[model samples]
Target: MRIRAAEEPQPGVKWIDEGGARMKFLEVDDNTIDVNCDTWASCEDELHARHLFIRWAQFACCWSQGMMASKMIN
Candidate 1:
């Protein structure tokens, strides 16, 4: 899959697109990130967003292990 690089960091993203999908994230009290990536395009409003502790690993996306992004970032 091809990924468009961002000029700056962005939030919650996980994707592979043999078909299309979307994921969204929400933060809680500056402490956590809640994310959902539904393969089936379920109701956006009813995704029932929640929160959890955040991590750098969790936010990393658009590339798989050993790809250039991983190499450059590491």
Candidate 2:
């Protein structure tokens, strides 16, 4: 994922989920990005993968909503 400058991710901009865990958004009139994290698949041997995805999704949503990332940040 690209860590855009403060001026890039303007407020009120929404990220559109295209498919396969990928998202698309326009940073500006010309600059655009397709963020992909499509590795989230069924893990035949590891149930932990689902848990990991859930945890990560929660963290991301909270952060986007202006909640603290974590209380245990080191």
Q: Name the best candidate (by lDDT).
A: 2
Global lDDT of each model? 0.42, 0.48
- Candidate 1: list runs displaced more than 4 Å: 2-18, 41-74
- The TM-score measured for candidate 1 stands at 0.30
Prediction-by-prediction clash tally = 0, 0
lDDT per residue for candidate 2 within 1-74, as digits (tens), equals: 43445447676443323313544444454533334333345443345555657766875676545523443452
Report the number of the highest-TM-score candidate: 2
Where does candidate 2 stray beyond 4 Å? 1-26, 29-44, 67-74
Q: lDDT tens string, model 1, 1-74?
A: 33647434545553322434466777766655566664432222333222111222343443234445655785
What TM-score goes with each of the models? Answer: 0.30, 0.33
In model 2, the clashing pairs are none
Q: After best superposition, candidate 2 residue 74: deviation in angstroms?
A: 28
